[model samples]
Every structure is written in structure tokens, then in C-alpha cells.
Target: MTRRCGFAAVIGAPNAGKSTLTNRLVGAKVSIVTQKVQTTRFPVRGVALADEAQIVLVDTPGIFQPRRRLDRAMVRSAWGGAEDADAVVHLVDAPAQLGDSPADRRAQADVETIIAGLKASGKAAILALNKVDAVKREALLGVSAALYETGAYDEAFMISASTGSGVDDLKAKLAERMPEGEWLYPEDQTADLPARLLAAEITREKLYLRVHEELPYSAAVETTAFQERKDGGVRIEQTIYVERESQRPIILGKGGQTLKWIGQKSREDLSVILDRPVHLFLHVTVDERWADKRAFYGDLGLDYDA
Candidate 1:
């Protein structure tokens, strides 16, 4: 049998469940999931094998109105992911788009912006209405009809990424669209993210889960060292950079309890994913200008000037 391989860019607004869907398709956690918006800062490529086809899923950061340099860079990366893809899936929060809340309105607006961009690019995407379990069937049909009428999408799929509903069907569709070619990655490889970068992302996820509301948007995690020991375990050192001196104590907590908790949680997750014991150390630092540094953006594969 001949092999097929191609790229598929998953683009959507903040909190639209793109990462969740990508993980589902790849059958592994390639991107981190959290309750906060804009959690993903770079494009994560997850490899999924469907029979003879290899689908490279590009999970891009949430597209939103940019106010900061980092925000602009993330949005730019999102579009760049789409420009080079053989297929594009624009995931939307269906329930939110059908609701009247202020947050829902903002989500609907973002979806419209993506639709406009699709039209301008002369690309017909496959619209995937996510969170279908939360919305009524009629409401979903209405939303799907409205979006399809825009002539920007070639097909529509109502799926719940969290529950695995309608995912296999979507995967089959994506596989059918893949062009015939040689496999881009090994069959056993689930993701293309490097170990050091994945470690940093895992710690960063813990940080946001612990101090999301208390900490500002300037927090970043860098893995300074990752070493394999003779005992077949990994030793990792990471630094969590915050924008203010006052934020350090908050992350450290009383008697260093908070930082300890974060480190413990991160280590546990890493051990399970890596299938080995992990010794993780976390330090909180004050770097008010970390977001402005070019190297910081380069590390994450984002263009700093964007």
C-alpha cells in the first residue's frame, strides 16, 4: 500500500479546545490544556497515524486581539501554521457562539474574524463545531448553517473534543484528504515537541494552574537543565520568571510550600509521561522584561518582532 502524509493546521480562538482535539487525534498529550485563555504560545505539531496516512496536526495558539508584543507574535504564528498546511480545521465553541453572555459574544466575534480570514485567503476549511455536547442539536444546526453559508468552509463537523465524540469520523476525513507521499515521522512517534521544551511547558502549565489569577500574564518557564541519571531517572531544573518582585513570594508561598507543591505536581506528570522517575526543581525569579527579550521568543519558535 502507498503511504500518505500531510499537514493539517487547527486554528481557533482562545479556549476553543484546539489542543484538546489535537491530543485526541494524536492519541497523546502533545499540547497542554488549562482553563485559562491564551495558554498555548507556539505551534505544536502532533503526529497521528490513520492506516497508511500520517496526519501532522499543527496546534496553533488561540487567535485574539493583540495588545502586547507576545500576543502579536502568537497570533502571527497561528496564521503561519495555516498558510503552509495541506488542510485547515477551524474549531469553534458552538455552545458559546449560541449564547448571549459577554464572553460568548467575544468568542463568536473571534470565529467570525477567522472566517473572514479564510475567505480572504481563498481557502475553504473544514469547520469543526466543538463542545457539541453542551449545545442543543437545533442550536448546533443553526450555528453550522450560518457558518457554512459564509462559503468559507467545505464541510462541518459537530464534535465534543473532551468526550471523544465525533472524533474518529473527523480523523477519517482528515486521513482521506492527506496527499499520497512518504510518511513524515516514525509510526511510533506521537509528537514532534522536544524533551526540554516539553518539560518547560509542563512546568508552565503547573504554574498557571496554581497561580493563574494571582500572577500576571508575564510568567514564563524555562528548563535550564535536563539530565539523565545512571539510575534511569531524569533530573530537571526549571526557572519560572514573573514580572514583579512581589509575585515571587506568592509563588514561593509561606515556608516555600507553594513552589514545592508546583514542583511535585510537575514531576509526577513528567514521570508518568516519560515512563521514568523525575527529580524536578523549580525556582521563581523576577524578570519584568522577560517578554521583551528576543531569546525568550526564539526559544518557543515564535518571531519576537511579530
Candidate 2:
């Protein structure tokens, strides 16, 4: 049997279930999912095996109006992912686009920006309407029709990423588009992220889950060290950076309970994912300019100058 492999970039507005869809297609949690928007900061490559085809899923950051350097870099990274991929999947939050709330309006506006970007690039994408279960079929059809009329999409699919509805069909379509080639990774490898980066990402996910409202996007997690011990266990040390000294209390909590909970939850998940006992250590620091640092962008594969 001939093997096929290609990159598929998944682009969308914040909270459009791109991460969830990537995880579902890859059959594992390679990207972090959270209720907060912009939880994904970089492109996470997840490998999905569809028979003889290897679908390299590039889960890019959500495209939004840029207000800061970090936001600009994130948006640039998102478009860069789409520009380099063999296929592109533009995922849209159906219910949000059909709603009238401020957030919903912003989401809809972001979707329009994405469509315009695609048009400017002269690239046609496969539109995937996410969270279809949350909206009526009539509304979905209307939304689908309006987007399809934009001429930026070649195909449309209504899918509920959370419930695994219509996901297999989308995956198969992506697989069929892959060009014939040797697989880029081992059959068992699901992601290409370094262990240190993956560890930091996991800790960052837990941090966001704990203090999404209190902490802004200024907080970052970095794995300082990962060591294998004699007992077949790993010791990982990470530092969580906050932009302001006042924000420290929110992460540390009263009696350091919040940070403790984040560390415990992260360690539990890391142990299960790594299939080894993990001793996770977390520390909090106030770095007002971490986002502006060049090293930070280099670590995340983002264009700092963007």
C-alpha cells in the first residue's frame, strides 16, 4: 500500500473548538483546550493516521484583531501556518456567529477577518462549522450559505467537535487530500513537540484553568528542567511568570493553595500522559516583560518582530 502525508492547517477564531477538533482527529490531547479564548499560543503539530495517510494537523493560534505585539505575533503565526500547509481547515463557531452578544459579535468579526485573509491570499479552504449541536440546522444552513457565498471555501462540514459528530468524515476528507509520500513520523508518535515544551504547555493549561479570569495573557510557563531519576520517574521544574507583582497573589492564592492545586492537577495529567511517575515543581515570578522578550517568541516558534 502506498503511504501519504501532508500538513493540514486548522485556523479559526478564538474558542471555535480548533484544539478539540485537532485532539479528536489525532485521537489524543496534543493541544490544550480551555473555556478562555487564545489559550493556544503557538502551532501544535499533531499526527493523525488515516489508513496509509498521515495527516499532520497544525493547530494554530486563534486569529483575532491585534492590539499588542504578542497578539500580532500570534496572528502572524496563524496565517503562516495556513500559508505553509497543503490543506487548510477554517473552523467556525456556529452558535457564536449566530448570536448577538458582544463576545459573539467579536467572534463573528474574527471569522470575517479570516475569510478576508483567505481571499487576500487567494487560497480556498474547507470550512468546518463547529459546535453545530448548539445551533439549529436551519441556522447552520444559513451560516454555511453565507460563508460559502464568500467564495473562500471549497467545501463545508457541520461538526460538533465536543461530541465527535461528523469528525470522522472531516478526517477522511483531509486524508484523501494528502499527497503520496513516506510517513514523516513513527506510527505511534502523535505529536512533535519537545518534552520540555509539552510539559510547559500542560502546566500553562492548568494555570489558565485555575485563574483564567484573574490572570490575563501575560502569564507564561517554562520548564526549567526535566530529569529522569533512578526509580524510573521524572522530576520536572517549571516557573510561572506573571506581568505584575500584584498578580502574584492570584496565582499563589491564600496559603499558596491555588498554585498547589495547579501543580497537583498538572502533575497528575503529566504522569498519565508520560506513563511515568512525575515530581512536578512549580514557582511563580513577576516578569513584566516576558512577552516582549525575543527568547519567548523563539521558544514558541512565533515571529517576535511581527
Candidate 3:
């Protein structure tokens, strides 16, 4: 039998459900997801099989206006993921793109930025208007027409990544684009991320979900150690780094309840993902320059100087 395998880069603005769609396409939780925007900081490769085709999906970071080094790096990575891919899917939050609220306007602006970038690169992408369940069909059609007129997208699809609606069609479309080759990964493999990195990301997602507004963006998680026990479990140690000393208490909370909750929730997820008993230890540290550190960016597959 002939085999096919290729990369498909999923690019979009923050909170456009790129991670959600990627997880759905891969039939596994390869990338972390939360309510926060720009939660994804790097490209995560999730392997999916559609018929005889193996589609390697690159879940890239949200493309947005870059003000900081980290933001620039993330935007660069998003585009870089598309550069070498066999197919590109530009996901957009439909309701937000068609709304008038200030936050919605900002989301639309990010989409516009991506569209312009696509035009400048002279690349065509499959536009996926996400969150169709939350928007009216008439309004979605209008938005789709306007974006399609930009001539940056080869086709458009309306989907609700949260509900798995229209996702299989998109997966099939991506599968059809795969080049003829040997499968890049084993049939059972779902993600390409290292165990240590995946553990850190899980802890980071928990931290982001627990913290109040804006605090999550200022926090970062690093897996300091991942050790396999003799019996058959794993012990993971991670450090949660915040920008200022004042932020430490915010994460720790009164009586360390907040940190405790974060650890417990993260451990639960790690256990399920690793399919083994996971002992997770978390520590909070104040590092004002954590975002500027080259080592931190390198660990997460980001360009520090971008």
C-alpha cells in the first residue's frame, strides 16, 4: 500500500481555537489550551492519520502585534511553521471577527495582520472560520466573503473546533494535501514534544487557568527535572517563575492554597497524559528577567532575539 505524510501548519490569532482544532485533528491533547490569549508559545507537532495519509499538524503560536521580544519570536514562529508546510490553515474566530466590541476589534486586527502577512509572502491558505456555533450563519457568510475576497485564502471552511463540527472535513482536506512518502511517525504516536517539555506545559496551563487576569501572561513554567522511578512511575519537578516579588504571593496565595490547587490539577493531567503515576513538585520563584532570558526561550523552542 502507498503511504503519504506531510506537514500542515495551523496559524491564527490568539484565542482563535487553533490549539483546540489541532487537538481535535490529532485525536489527542498535544497542545495546551486555556481561555487566555497567546497561551501557546511554540510550535507543537501533532500526528494525525486520515485514511492512508499521515498529516503532521504544526500548531503554531498565535500571530499578533509584536511589542516584546517574546511576542516577536512567537509571531515569527507562527509564520515559520507555515513556510515549509504542505498546507496551511488560517483559523479565525468568526464571532469576534464580526463583532464590534473593543476586544473583538482587537481580535479582528490580529486576523487582518495575518492576512496581510500571507499576502506579502505570496502564499495561499485554507481559511477556517472557527466558532461557527457561536455565530449566525448569515453573519458568518458575510465575514467569510470579505476575508475570501482578500485573495489570500484558497478556500474557506466554517467550523466549531470546540464541538468537533466540520473538523473531519477539514482533516480530510488536509490529508488530501499530504505528499507521497513514508509515515513520519508510528501509528500510535500522537505528539512530538518531549516528556519534560510537555509536563512543563501542563503545569503552565494550570497556572494560567488559576491566576487572575494578566497574571498568567507574566508567569512561566520550567521543568527542572523528570525522573523515571524504578517501579514504573515518574517524578517531575517544575519551577513557576513570575516577574516580580509581589507576584509570588499571588501565585502562592494565602496558606499556599492557590499553588496547591495548581499543583494538584497539573499532576492529575500529567498522570493521564503520561499514563503512569506522576508525582509533581512545584516551586515559585521571582525572576524579573525571565522573559528576557535566552535559555528560557531556547528551552521552549522560541527565538530569544526575535
> lDDT tens string, model 3, 1-306?
688999999999899999999999999999999998899999999999999999999999999889899999999999999998999999999999878998899998998899999999898999999999998889889999999999999988989999999999999999888999999899999999999999999998888888857485788899999999997999999999999988998899899999999999999998999999999999999999999999988988888888
Q: Candidate 2: minimum summed lDDT over ten consecutive residues — where? A: 210-219
Superposed by TM-score, candidate 1 places the C-alpha of residue 47 at a distance from the truth, in angstroms, of 0.8
Q: Over the stretch 1-306, how does candidate 1's per-residue lDDT look in tens digits?
A: 889999999999999999999999999989998777889999999999999999999999998888999999999999999999999999999988888998998898899889999999998999999999998889889989999999999988989999999999999999989999999898999999899999999888888888888876778999999999999999999999999999999899899998998899889989988899999988888889999999999999999989
Compared with the true structure, the alpha-carbon lDDT of candidate 3 equals 0.92
Q: Candidate 2 clashing pairs?
A: none
Candidate no. 1 TM-score: 0.97
Number of the predicted model whose lDDT against the real structure is largest: 2
- Prediction 2 global C-alpha lDDT: 0.95
lDDT digits (tens) for residues 159-254 of candidate 2 = 999999999999999999999999999999999899899999999999999999988778999999999999999999999999999999999999
TM-score of 2: 0.98
The runs of at least 3 residues in candidate 1 whose Cα sits more than 4 Å from the true structure, single-residue gaps closed, are none
